[model samples]
Target chain A: MNIIISNTAGTPIYEQIKEQIKAAIFRGELKEGELLPSIRRLARDLRISVITTMRAYNDLEQEGFVVNMQGKGCYVQSQNADLLREHKLREVEKHLHASVVAARLCELSDDELLNMLKYFMNEEDEYE
Target chain B: MNNILELNGVFKSYKTFALEDITFALPRGFVMGFIGPNGAGKTTTIKLILNMLQRNAGTIKVFGKDNIFYEQEIKEKIGVVMDNTFYVDEWSLKDIERTLKPFYKRWDSGKYNSFLSDFRLDVNKKVKEISRGMKMKLMIAIALSHEADLLILDEPTSGLDAVARNELMEILSEFIEDENKGVLFSTHVTPDLEKIADYITVINNGRILYSGIKDDLLEKYVIIRGGLDVLDDEFKTKIIGCREHNVGFDGLIDSSVLPLLPKNIITERSNLDEIIVRFNNWRENK
Candidate 1:
């Protein structure tokens, strides 16, 4: 219900849902063993396709972020904090790699790239 | 992945208009833009889906259940926003919400209130006292609060300003962010669908002319402009619509046959509006 989506974001809809749920779990917004909304309920609430929500749930389950009980519905699963941290770090690395490639393409100097990153990090910190 | 709603070999008749062999599906999580010229059975198709009017023939299924057998269950999961507001004129936003809350088992008052605030709607304002845009926002708020899996909207942008329309699109885009929700947006405004619609089902003269992805619809057809010198018998047959000009002729060409054109003609990408207009015009003459 608190979800936001970007129409122009390169991320696919399912990935967006998956990443948001993961972030929510990581932030403890969704506590371990907490019950998540049913796929039908979430789809209706979000006005999204049930399949898209289902894919997100399935992906989350696969990632050990949630568990689906037969006929009972899905729930946030207990996670290894270390593993989650590693996963998050890997994602950041990939993003940084892409950013560096883009920065290189734009012919940004090391100082310029560092300044831009610092500015963005500071802006993001303010929001949180 | 299954059809949330489908009509097979469906037919409906009015005194002057009819829907013939109408078959289409709204797959789960996919938005199907139900498009057509005015009075071209777009509303009729929606009516058939809701069973507001009985179909003359064929079957309809919602959530893989026969429509007739699961009408109430289906209705409970479906959120409908028609072009016209059906609420009582004297009813306030709160009054409407109060009236509808008891009908949906999953109705969330908190969510409803939040939506009203987000949409900047006043709960005490009478339905008739609100502007058309505000009324639309109210309807959307109600629709979102009901926890319905499918949202069916008919001409939601018809009378709205660009900003309001963009707001509505943003809301819908967010709604579908979960991917479990599907939207059937019926509109004459092709440009809006150009931005958000995943699949398009276009009807004209009680028949489906095109039904598929927006990209495929754009890719499968093209607009070609050139002089009479560039025209030929083979070229004419492939045209969907053509218009004469002082200097030349411009027309729609099936992209599949683009190679058939002589080397000098200009072919450009066509959008939903151009395709719909050309198809309707061609049908009119035929």
Candidate 2:
């Protein structure tokens, strides 16, 4: 899989690598059982620190999107369909969280916030 | 965790300058950027590690043995690339290698010859005849040929151009492909370190201001900028080496204080260069 990093993205480089790999996995570009590039090789190719790639791989492993085999290498996990759905669900939950904070800032009542959510749903439905 | 090199409370003194409480460790399988402004005891610290200079107090260990005790054993395994070479200036590359080859047990002539060709250095050229970048590459070639586990570089990238520096990074990344090898690279060129260094140890006036993972250190500090009017005493307290002008003021501050900043203030992530400069500025301000 090809991964590009942008220093100007305002996010840390390691996060960019992690998110890109996660996106690649979700897109089925990285198939299950496909071995990822060795951490040092990736760092060398990308001209980034070995630790940065190590961090990204470690994080992916911890998050269950990747698995490490001792002395073997990292590989994309099996059963990615449920994992993919779980990731998208987390994103939706995060946006809803931000919406709640924004609604609280505006001092909107619970009913008003619920009505706004309904309005958005209907708008999206009409577009569909 | 195995440490290739460790220094604790390593103190050294001269007539007017001194290094105190110099402590840091380079773990195996990574690179540590040894950074500081000029005359900040970086070279002195390296010298102490190499046993070229004596420390007044504290301990230094290389490969789990006291540095002084294992000086020869450690020297064989630790490659040193100082800003200048000590090889006879008139000696050709081949002659130089021939002179130094006997000192190393695992001197691979084939590897040395290939690296010289890869660097495009003529084997017949005298040591003083090559460019600075070539000289740097030659040192690295020698370092690698001897199968050194730890590479200590002092200002190795000083005179090299950006392309040369990037090439050096590639070579260094390849060098540490083995998990047992490590590097302690000292340079004023912070951007080079930013790309390849796993950890950073920032020293100033012979003291370590910060020493830890490079990412964490970068994440810890931020650049704060705002109009001079925003420079209240409370806000100023959080800033380091605050530079004030009629129009605005800017300085480095811990990211933890970002929440306390007002809406008018601007915050940006601090890079290694900015951090080092602001630190030196802080010294001047003090």
TM-score of each: 0.70, 0.92
Residue-wise C-alpha lDDT for candidate 2, range A45-115, written one tens digit per residue = 88788888999999999999899999999999885567778889998999999899778767889999999
The residue pairs found clashing in candidate 2 are none
Q: What is the C-alpha lDDT profile of model 1 across B55-132, one tens digit per residue?
A: 899998888998888898888888888877999999988898889888888899999999999998888989999988
lDDT for each candidate structure:
0.83, 0.91
Top model by DockQ, which number?
2
Candidate with maximal lDDT: 2
lDDT string for model 2 (B215-267, tens) is: 99999999988998778998887888888988999999999878778766777
Candidate 1 Cα deviation (angstroms), residue B155: 0.7
Those runs of model 1 whose alpha carbons end farther than 4 Å from true positions after fitting are A1-128
- Top TM-score hit: 2
Backbone clashes counted, model 1: 11
